[model samples]
Target chain A: MKNLNRRDFLKTAALGAAAATLGTKSAKASEKLLSEDRLGVLVDTSVCVGCRHCEWACRLAHNMPSPALDYYSNPTVLKEFRRPDKTALTVVNEFENDKNPNLPIHVKIQCMHCDHPACVSACIVGALTKNEDGSVVWDDGKCIGCRYCMVACQFQIPTYDYDVSIDPHIRKCDFCTERRKEGQLPACVNICPNEALVFGKRSEILRIAKNRTKRKPDIYINHIYGESEIGGTSWVYIAGKDFNELKMPPLGKNPAPGISEAIQHGIFAYFVPPVTLYALLGTIMWVTKRRNESADKDKHDHHSDSHDHHSDSGRDPYRTSGHNTYRDSGHNTYRDSGLSTDKDTKGDNL
Target chain B: MKPAPVKHRFFTPGVIILAVLALNGLIFLAVRFISGLGAVTNLDNNTPWGLWIGVDVAAGVALAAGGFTSAALGHVIHREHYHAIVRPALLTALLGYTFVAFAVCVDIGRFYYIWHPLIMWNGNSALFEVGICVMIYMTVLYIEFLPIVTEKFMGKVNLPGFLETFNEPADKLLRMLNSGLSKTMFIFIIAGVVLSTLHQSSLGTLMVIAGQKMHPLWQTPVLPLLFLLSAIAVGFPMIIFESLIASRSFKMKPEMKILSRLGSMVAPILGVYLAVKIGDMFISDDFKYILKFDVPAWMFMAETGLIIIAFVLFLSKETTRSPGRLFLASSLVIAGVLLNRINNFIVAYKPLYDPVAYFPSFGEISVTVGCIALLVLIYRAVVIYFPVISHK
Candidate 1:
């Protein structure tokens, strides 16, 4: 019965291991996902005219409620800074351009579509995918509305509809994956009246951003925002003001999920650590049990020996005289124990 | 002596108050379901998770570490003396994880799709690890609690309907199950400890991907280590806390001898945790961030201070020997760990464009408090109905 049980256990364990291996593959960010010829967007905030047309166009493309085209012309809403929320996938916030006081810089904010997107790495269900074309898109069918992606996003881009309890989507900019497939630019990029928003190959736009900054040094900042931030985002930006002044989150060059994933993989590395700890703990338990039982038996033996000595002294003192040497050894132990001089006398009498 | 059900009347003034709190929470919960989370919570687009995920889920999971810690000590280490306290701790973990799963369902926007994590796979996500571990551990806990059920109703099963014909069969089935479980119980006992360790640490990893948005005072690569250590440290105290409360309510003498010994071990564990925590702060040079004395800084100070104070209280012989002082110390540790989870999830998350700071609304507070009160009431009911707490 025990042999059969052991075989069954091993069989079950092997099957479990197989299921676990086939169960969860690492997200797309597991390997280097930078496909050659990947697209990117370059935003020149210096050339933006604060039209807010991109905001209107973004809402229209994503099937969100959009007001009339003239409604976005209202500069009153631009007074206070805004972020992309459930109501809008992207919003252009107007920041004061110190270089030119008259014309405020209208910077369009959306998902950066990072090459190493944290949301894609962080989504519990693999609901968010990082496409090879350099767009991070959320699958509505896969999202469980955990909102972990929102927390993981460094850009604070993804938004949720808290008002709608059921089937609420994780709203985020998908970089117009649909339009790009149709050979059209993103709605925001298409409607940009000032060619301020340029969409092309990531490498080409990166070179273009650097050249533009180099050609007009006074008009743009030396650093191309998102060029290398958080391992190079697909959305690069050039503004006269600092990126912080543009309200972009300060991030290190390393990817956001680097440390977390390393620790995760290290803990479950081939399931060796957990299984080793399990075996080690099982051995300890087994050893402790054996030691405890043996200790109890030793105590029982000592009690039984004392009873035998009592019986020999009380009833048949001369019967076990051949065991005197053993008694003498016991006397030595009694002396060393120092539990009591009474036991020592009893040993000497023996 | 074998554990037996505590014989007591169900209703009391405290229980009445708890019932009222549960009722009040249910009303708000109904509103939450009907109108939406926006009606009940302060959560919006800027802050997706709030009190439910922080206090109800994270803190709940952390405090439930007593189940694994006691299991490790009693069963894995074969410390026969600790066997008396193990059952109660298991019950708490079982209930705690159940509520945690329930809270996740309630908190998620698509409540019906809470099972997506089971089929969907994301190996890199910390939440996925936590979710899977928690689900498996809860199952292990339920299986662990089955012996108590068998002990309670093995021969006493009396079906009240036409199903009464199957009473003997039910009893026989339970006997078979009891034998099977006894033969193979070690697998679940070890698995419970392993699953607990994995999830407790992964809960800390949940906040790591937040990067710079999380306050450096609470954010570190060693956060998972700190979380696991802190959870292990608090385990005995949580057992002590609930054990004392159970003893008081049942009008039984507190097991001071075993409890004091348990309390004695807490200091060393807590010392290790505090050393690692402060050492990490120094290693990262985030100690300066604390000196800035902002809200996050103050929250951080309060969290560590409570732990330091609890650690000191635990070291004193008098505190452990006396039930009141031990209770106070345990409460301190519980509050400290609870605050740590909150500080990490809520206070530490600072987005770039947040217009206002996030705080739990009245409705959210009502539901959280209500759920806890309800949990305690259920705990009381279980102890009364089952053979859990042992009498010496």
Candidate 2:
């Protein structure tokens, strides 16, 4: 029985090891997804006019609250790094490109809609889901409003509607899923007079971006902001200046969600191992119960047979002496220690 | 054994104080639910988690470590002498989880959707595991406590037909349930151990996923290991602390020998924990981050200092046995543990470009305090009424 217990322990440990390996593998598998015909946008800093038209159109299209700053305002909000809030669906921030300070690089900040979104993975209630079309959508009904998605989002795109006390919602740029589903351009794309924000099939967007960069080497930077950034955001950007100056993190091609998903699954995959362990433990407990009962019955029979000769024996000698020694060594060891005192007191003595 | 008649001796000053605290807490919770999180919390975009997660959930769980201690020794380690303490420990675990669930409700902005876990199951979510495990474990704990319920409440109904049921069949029912639960208890005990292990570690893991948002001092791969070890190290001591206070209030003798033995076990584990922490820092080459003159760095030092003080105090052979000294050490360990959790989840997590910082409002604090008070009241009510503390 002891050997069998050890073997079971080993099997469980082995299963745990296998589960961990499987978890890591699943994480890698999800990461290995390649999108060849992906659509993206390329924003060239050389041509941006710091127009708030895209922001206006985004708000109008999403039915979000208009910003306090009218479209004709001085565009001073562009000076600071600003993101789309609950009210504002998109915001254009101006970054001073050292290559051409006279022409301020206006970067439109919104949800990147990464190929693998952290928000989708972070949401335990299935409130957030990333579509194959690459648009990340939110289902408020399933949402616990935990705001974990907001916390997990690397770009800090998701915002909470804190004012809505009755039914709060997390607001984020959805890449204009409604517009795209209707085969129409995003509001921001449709309003871009300079052709600065382009929305198309991700594959075509990549092609156009590459073609533009190749044709005008001196005008545009060699990099496409979303082509491989953070495992490829749906909306791509073509930049004349460095992306970092525009507050774009130096993200890797590996999406933030993929690695996190891997780690999350790796840790939680141990769930199955425990259930199997519980079954084994239950069996052991059952067997022990039966053994204990049988042992008690045998002791009772032995006592009855020995009653004439050994009437002095107590009802439960096992409780008083035999088991008690092994039962509580911590207190018993401290109270009446054997190894420290007498060597001969080891014969099941209490 | 036939459960003795429950003695009702209310109007004690302790009960009154507890009652007042409970009332105050309820009012505070009302304010929290109505006024929104900003009205009563120090939470911000940078630090999404704060005092509630730190003290209420993390610290509360550690204090309830009695469950793990009793269950592990009695069930896993298979030392039958400590069996008497298991039920109380299980009770503490149940109450602690109940408080944690309440904290989650109040702390979460759209707490109404918390039921989303059961309806919308996301297999990949850590919070899903935490939510599901805690909920199920809470149920299992209550089920474990049912024998106590039967022994106490069922025996007192006094209806003629019901009274007849209590005589022979009731004894059999209790035995069958006890044996059945015992047969099933190992699974839940193991489940509790495993679930607590994962969630406690995941508390640290939750911060790790925050990436650059968290301070370097708190972020490390070994956080899971650290949190789990601390929970284990503090588990038995917390039990000792709770039992000591109960013994004092109930006018019973302290379980000195048991507590002393537990203390000795904890001291070595604390030493090992310290070694692992320092060794992890050294290996990661993140030791310099601890020296930085920043809030995260100072918080780290303070957390380490508290643990060290507790370890040193309890490490002594003489101090381990003294009930008062053991209590002090346990308090420090708990304080250090709480501080570590808070610093990691709240104070240390600083993201760039966050304009606002969060502080739990009076309402938030009230709700948290109230939840704790309720747990205490429940615990007191149980121990006073039931056979929680075994006879001398």
Instruction: Provide the TM-score for each candidate, comma-separated.
Output: 0.89, 0.84
lDDT of 2 at A103: 83
Per residue, candidate 1 scores C-alpha lDDT tens digits across B91-182 of 99999999999888889888888889999999889999999999999999999999899988889999999999999999999999998998
CAPRI classification of candidate 2: acceptable
Tens digit of per-residue lDDT, candidate 1, span A92-194: 8888889878988888889999988889889999999988888989998889999999999989889988787667889989999888789889999999999
By summed lDDT, the worst window of 10 consecutive residues in model 2 chain A runs over A341-350
| Per-chain TM-score (chain B), model 2 | 0.90
Off by over 4 Å in 2: A1-20, A31-35, A67-72, A79-81, A97-101, A207-223, A268-272, A279-350, B1-18, B44-46, B159-184
Point out the worst 10-residue segment of candidate 2 chain B by lDDT. B1-10
Off by over 4 Å in 1: A1-31, A295-350
Against the correct fold, how does model 1 do in TM-score? 0.89
Predicted structure with the largest lDDT when compared to the true one: 1
lDDT of each: 0.83, 0.68
**What would the per-residue lDDT of candidate 2 be over residues B16-108, giving only the tens digit for each residue?**
788888899888666667766655665654555677877787677666766865776656554444554566677788889888888888767
